[model samples]
Target chain A: MRRLAPAVGPLLLGLALAAACHPAVAGLLGDGGANRPLSLTRLSDLALNHLTLAASGFAFVACLGLGLGLVVTRSRFAALRGGIDTLAAFAQAVPPVVVVALALPILGFGGPPTLLALAAYGIMPALRGTVGALESVSPEAREAARAVGLTPGQVLRQVELPLAASGLIETLRTAFVLAVAVTAVGALAGASTLGTPIVAGLQNQNVVAMFQGTAAAAALAFLGDALLLAAGGLARREAA
Target chain B: MRRRIILGLAGAAVVPTLLVLLPLMHFAPNRLLTGTAIDAPSILGAMLWPLGALAAIGPGLLAGSRGRLAAAIAALACLGAFALLLAGLGHGAAAWTAGQPPAARARLAAGAWIGASLLAAAVPLGARRVDPAAGGPIGALALAASVQGLWLAGRLDALSVVVEFRARRDELAAALLDHLALALGALALAALVTGALALWRRGRGLVDLTVSGLQVVPAVALLGGLVTAASALLSAAPALRTYGLSALGTVPALVGIAAYLLLPLWRGLQGALRAPDAASLDAARALGLTPRQILTGLRLPLGASVLLGGVRVAAVQALGLATLGALVGAGGLGTLVFDGMAQFAPDLILLGALPVIALSLAAERALSGLEAAARRHWPS
Candidate 1:
């Protein structure tokens, strides 16, 4: 059960993506509007942009979470740690609509803000996992590192982090899946992503377009999840 | 002692300033405030005075031996003040009374009084009893004040304030103060409800049921449904037609979207409760407490981290979802996005999208602090 649970993300992603490309499925792409051939050019553009956004969001969140996780562990400053975590959670709780509304007047719109929101939303899982994983590292291992004259940074880098890597990777995978799923929502703000088709489909009540867009989104989410699971597995093996 | 007091006061001042005041200062309504046609300032003053009175009564309730009784009285006084203030403000009341005969005002006043009385009766009963062992009265007062501040901030119209500020930049400081108060009210209400619920239920399913159900509903679909429902209700009932509920766009859409965003927080808390260590449960049981006692005294304290963690998630989600409010005429960031889309203006879209993103990032940072605090006090 445990082993298979990890495979769900990847399996779902692959199947959905593959299904989107089938000839029988071309009817689902929604009106296709003026863009003819339903060609590989558009598909490639989407795949590339989607991947880039996902990657950027993923990388940003991972780094943010890492720094935050480290700060939380090293600093005995309870209030500071508490404050940061609360902020992150509140950020997570806020409806994406509200964030966009609140941000519109200040930051304007576009790829940057959308990416920023995705990155922000994505960080929580990884940050949380890092904290939990690091805390769970055996105290004895930490003490051994200390007794051996390892600096605190050295202890974290050489001992605690490596031991906690598997858990951290799992957390990142969850974040990645979430980011991929929500990236489509970026279309609502006009980021020129796959969600554009879906939104257009909804506005026009075009079922084919809606199906195409939804299928693409679901596929992307699944693929992203799968990739993360594979990465997590590989990391676990490396740790072992 | 002085340092601690100073620190507390600073926090009291700073939090509202950043979250509510700053936003309001940046967006206070210019036309409404500047126009001589309405007694807007006087109305506002009338509202604030009674609210201030309510705030004053809070401390006495917290301090007295008959705390529950005192709180009940204070709550009643607050409700009475709120009614008087609302009546004096006139805008909300006028809107409510529109198209209705003058005779309805008496009924409305009576209804308001009855409602206030019921709310007062409910407050003390719902108040969480302070743990006798948990430090001094100062801590309790601080908690109460914090709650009040948050409540004040959250319930305010931040968008209107921001719009006002944009139009009248000179009044930025006052606008910001008002906005802060509103945001504080919102935060306070959320905190109080979530905190109180956490204390009472301790690992129960209410949060999960509410939040997860909310999560599964897609935002667009939810908004559509809400708009449809609002239109139907308004058209079907003559009374609602006066309020213009059938008006399409931002308001209805935003309300729907906001409703949809609540699920994750609810579910997140539920998930957190389920995530706690089993050993802690056994330990509580071993201490000779009943299940109810165990939950209130032990599990709740232990689970505070997770519960709050859930809240942080919900709050961030809510912030993001609020941007979509503009689609239904609720008017927030979605207005920018939708308008940009209509006109094919990338700059406008970027303008709208950027703020949503920044707000989300900022919210994430804020919630991170809450999560950390939860972990600290309720160490796994």
Candidate 2:
């Protein structure tokens, strides 16, 4: 934690400072001719939508990923892990926007397609993190817990989960950040997001709008990164 | 063993359940409108029996198989069953579209794609129960052979995706070339930049920081920022526009992609360079080998696999990210994807997406093979 502080401190500070200055940046860039600049309230609203979509999708992916990871790590389900790991790797190689575009046909446009894409794209990181974190828990510890006559469920809840907490938190953080990124791409699918301005501005050649949108989107990602980093820091400290 | 059997049985149940629950195909009068659905088991009369037989026998073999060879054979049977079901769908589509206009499309719908994908997934998942490595090779071979046979028999000619391909053959070729160029160009740029930086020991910290900072920004935001910056530059010196230094299109896309690729490439190179341990380096030094000779003779050979591993990741990511080039008017396959989104043409979107997926997978597999070969030869 101490070593991480030097790196984390400046990153957090820089992101926050950049994010804090967005309104001023927007003002400086000015509005493109005949196009209304996104007001602070509108930008906040879009950011909220972006976060909401990311959080909702992250929630679904977290549950699915954690469940799958737990199942595959069990002794009986070991054989299934290799196949799933391969599939997850393959899925991760596809770009998030392409996933959104592919889902658009099946789910139609708007929030549903965006949500589906977010879940699909985010699953790989979450699952890999969970499996890795769980696997990192020493076998000796699990054996000790079992030797104490703790049931499999009890061992998992009391022994494994506690040991895995920091790793799990880190996984969630990575997965959440990924969800945030995918939400920005979800703008192409007509989901109202920080990416909305970016896409609209691109079509209209509104440079100011584009800049503002890009800034806000970056701000959202940075904010998410900071919050998650703090949470991960707390987890690491608790574990220590 | 009981769990494996249960899993096999559950896998076998997926296709039949999906077939009943969802429509097998969607038929549109033209490309513009949402189509009516054709359900399998209801419309495909005699084809269902063979599919049913294969499904049952595939799972039975999985349950009965105690050896890796048997499990592999079971995987092959399951994949062949999936192929036969798809061929049946193609035949059904042909029958449905017999009297329709040229614009009419009869394509496999959500059910077929979802069901077939699940079934395909099941083959490996089931086969791997006996042996972890038993499934993939057999499944791929079976899939390729059946797809080829179906294509040669003209069984898949009526599929809307095939029809879409036929209609846009020339445009598809151009898009393919553009897509390849964008991805490969960005990869080459990243390789050169990272290679130079990796050798500059004094600038390592700053380079790492810059790469991480670039990664922190989302790809879209990075691309947008590049567009803004490039436009600013071009406007400041309009003379540069004549030299093809435009704000939008290929320039921003290429730069953004290369920026993202830097971190992976740099990390991989660092890992590879460090592959020779302290003892090995000390021994090489004691042997009176110069630093440059040590690098080429020991580090390069030993670290080849690690380097290739990194390149594999960056290359695959580049291919995927290049699709966004279309968004900036660079005119890659993503143009088809976005155009499909705007026009609500699913086949057009598939035409773009499937190729990108294939390209990424192919790069991944090819690089992995090379990495394995490196590890074999060097044993590091």
Candidate 3:
């Protein structure tokens, strides 16, 4: 109960804020549009789809980024570090929308292209985080673990990863937040995320649907951030 | 004597060589339909020598202090090859459409784009891996010279993007200017706001809350919120419209971009202001320097690089977010991108996107160089 206490604040704050905003339906807002009024069932369905896309994108990025970060940091592979940095810098320079647009031709309109773009855009943050977190592990800890006659793999698992857990969690938080935000841009590529209505509104000049979509997207992003914060809090407490 | 190969050079060259095996161009009968892939070998027949040369030199570059000159030469060779490859791609694009009507299109496919971007980016990395000091300036000069050469000869004119650009030349120029104005204008505003907040000192909590709160909002949503608020205000006070304040254009776009920029700018400002060592600050105090003198004479000088570091981040981010401005009719390069998307013309989209990517990368490189120069002067 003590460990879980810190998680409750953000979780409750997120929920309370979300609930407060829930009543500002399209009809109440009164900006005229032909689009359907945003109902609770429809809203939740959109939210779930958004979450699914973001989660899958995050998962793919985490695996590839973590693996690449690990491999490049190894002694024998140190020569590849400069190349990885250059590639990562290039990746960062290209905007997420551009990635989505470019992927549209190859992957066609829908979830797959959005997913690919999200994965591409998210890779840089995850890779940078893993590399930075692992590097932050004190050299002394590794040396001490080695002195205890532990194998290289054992030292990494028992010493380095344990020490780097907090930073890694922080990295995941950043990556997840990014995934959530970029997924909204996925609507441009025909993925039925929250940005769907915003794009639709823009096309039809439907101010109300755009406003509602914007509010819902913002709420969804905040909710994800809060959920991640709670999860980070729980992890820290467990580590302690 | 034992010879060790430079792995960076080897990897950089080999990857592009492998990518060449994939489709290098896409040929479509018209702008709106699916295209067929064209292989590199079919287009670049004799011109593939540059690529072959790069592959041959890849593993041959030596690793060691003695290999510095070799690395520099190799770097120049790699870039020169890259320039030639680009020219080949353009010419190939032209030839592939020679027999077809003007409505037919030939654009660089995924493989060529991926390979070209990778090679262009990797050459510097490979150079630095071997000889960090000798390669940067000379390589940059060579790249500039080659690009100028291509432009002078009009070799890249036949490429689909250049064709698109010729059609919308004036619009493209105006969009580029708008992009710069939006990004830089917002950057300046964020700096001022951050500077004011930093001076307030008591607003630390306010700054933290604002920064984190702003981050939670998706950028498009933020823009939408601003648009709604502005329009509502305009409706309530019709007189404000006389002052040229309206929703749906530069006003909301600037505010939204600046709103997102506050976090990075504020963090940078705080970090730079606090950069002076405690002992240095104490010494300045003991020497009877005023707070203003200490800040100007000590802190500002030392923290210049750190502040510039923050500006680089904010600038890159601003350039990217500016793309969303097109959604609100704030016309920029994204106009071309969204227009192309609506028409399903990949080449047209690339025409907008490629420039944006180039601008951000150029900004990052220039700012980083400034940061390094600042560090050298400050010695921190």
Clashing pairs in 3: none
Off by over 4 Å in 2: A1-22, A30-36, A140-159, B63-66, B121-138
DockQ of each: 0.14, 0.61, 0.57
| Best candidate (score: lDDT) | 2
Candidate 3 segments whose C-alpha is farther than 4 A from its true place = A21-27, A31-36, A203-208, B1-13, B16-20, B59-66, B129-134
What root-mean-square deviation over C-alphas does model 2 reach?
2.8
Return the candidate ranking by DockQ, descending. Answer: 2, 3, 1
Candidate 2: tens digits of C-alpha lDDT, residues B281-317: 9999999999999999999999999999999989998
The models' CA-based lDDT, in order, is: 0.53, 0.81, 0.78
**fnat, candidate 1?**
0.11
Tens digits of per-residue lDDT, candidate 3, B1-380, equal 33243444555456456656778888888876668888877877788866767644643452222365766666666676678678888888878888889988787777777666655654675576565665565555666788789878988887777787888889889999999999999999988888888878788988878786787677777787788789879989999999999888999999999998898888777888899989999999999999999989998899999999889989999998899999888988999899989899887888899889989888888888889899999986
Q: Weakest 10 consecutive residues, lDDT, candidate 1 chain B?
A: B19-28
List model 1 lDDT by residue over B1-380, tens digit each: 45445544443232122222221121112311211122223323445554445533432333332344554454444444444433433333344335644323211122222333333322332243333222223333443454355345543212232222244444333423332333333344555555455666655476655644343334554554466556557767869767655646644653554454444445555556565478877887788879889767766677677776656655555555655555555555555556655654333444455455555555654565667777777676
- Give a tens-digit lDDT track for model 2, residues A1-240: 562463375466547644653665565665547345677888889888988998899899999999999999899777667667878877777777788888887787789988877877777878989999999999999999999999999999888888998789778877876787788888999999988888887777666666667666666666666666777677667656
* Candidate 1 wrongly placed segments (more than 4 Å): A1-5, A17-23, A26-44, A75-110, A123-125, A151-154, B1-305, B328-380
